[model samples]
Target: MAGGGGRSHGLSSSRSGPTSNLLFSCGKVAIVRTVKSGPNVGLKFHGCPLWPVSV
Candidate 1:
């Protein structure tokens, strides 16, 4: 649950349109983020609040 907390702030502005209603298994609102590196760079996605820690 380390990644689930302390990351919910500063994300309200990112939620907009149809994607604003999306939610993950952790009951947290998904945030939109773009891949900064790797082969999927520049690809946009709805980031899970528990990322890197699994559901």
Candidate 2:
């Protein structure tokens, strides 16, 4: 049940609104790894179970 909130600043400010709220259950380890070495880094998901309908 741990979470956080913050405000964006500078050129990275979003005019559309804030980022999406990520909701996850307990015991889930969320790892957001860097895919690139630039200002905008890509993300890859790991250890998440796939749904039958989505597959």
Candidate 3:
């Protein structure tokens, strides 16, 4: 039961995006992603675990 209007500005501005084993601003676990198919393949990025994507 969440709306799509509570997205935070800080989440979108995360240039680093999806770091491995990192903590979000809310103290949650971070979801890191590795590029498997791109020029920057194998690159790791950091992201928040509690981002309101479907707020």
Candidate 4:
């Protein structure tokens, strides 16, 4: 039988597809980004417009 719970398993499908627009928590549209450094360098993914900000 399938398991059921209130907790999310981090396997939910996003309503936005590859061609669809993805928005950030700040309400800004997410942008495609490329990793500049580290083991995942050159790895492309979606990012926020207000990233790398100083607190």
Candidate 5:
């Protein structure tokens, strides 16, 4: 029996092959953290490389 869930289409196609690169690649990856503002501050977090950056 074959496992079902993800589809083999678009970037998932075997022809495309496996990759470790990002789709909408950005300059560099950065560590996102929370601000110490009010009660929702100083919270460290992770985020995309192109969060608030524009090419």
Candidate 6:
């Protein structure tokens, strides 16, 4: 289970093989959070405004 901002993300899978189920489950949750928050976070590029700049 993964918790953030009073929310919880959980998963259940029953497949075992070369792929690690535990690792895949955790990675999925991380990806979701990253994608959800990525746009709101600031960019690392130089000379760029937090918001877009228009002429």
- State TM-scores per candidate: 0.50, 0.21, 0.36, 0.60, 0.31, 0.16
lDDT of 6 by residue, 7-46 (tens): 5334444577534343233344122222224665642321
Give the per-residue lDDT of model 2 (tens digit) for 10-47. Answer: 11222555453332343333333444666656855332
Model 5 clashing residue pairs (backbone): 35-41, 35-42
Between prediction 3 and prediction 6, the one with superior lDDT is: 3
Predicted model with the maximum TM-score:
4
Clashing pairs in 3: 3-55, 4-55, 17-45, 17-46, 18-45, 18-46, 18-47, 19-45, 19-46, 19-47
lDDT per model vs. reference: 0.66, 0.35, 0.58, 0.67, 0.45, 0.35
lDDT tens digits by residue: candidate 4, 1-55: 0367675322333577767666665677777799999998998877777778889
Predicted candidate 5 versus true structure: per-residue lDDT over 12-41, tens digit per residue: 112455443323234444345576588857
Higher-TM-score candidate of 3 and 6: 3
For candidate 2, the TM-score is 0.21
List candidate 3 stretches off by more than 4 Å: 1-21, 35-42
Q: Give candidate 1's error at residue 55 in angstroms.
A: 14
Q: Which 10 successive residues of model 4 have the least lDDT summed? A: 5-14
Off by over 4 Å in 4: 1-17
Compare the candidates by lDDT and give the number of the best one: 4
Worst 10 residues of 6 by lDDT: 43-52
Model 5 worst lDDT window (10 residues): 7-16
Task: Show the lowest summed lDDT stretch of 10 residues, model 1.
Answer: 6-15
Q: What is the lDDT of residue 17 in candidate 4?
A: 70
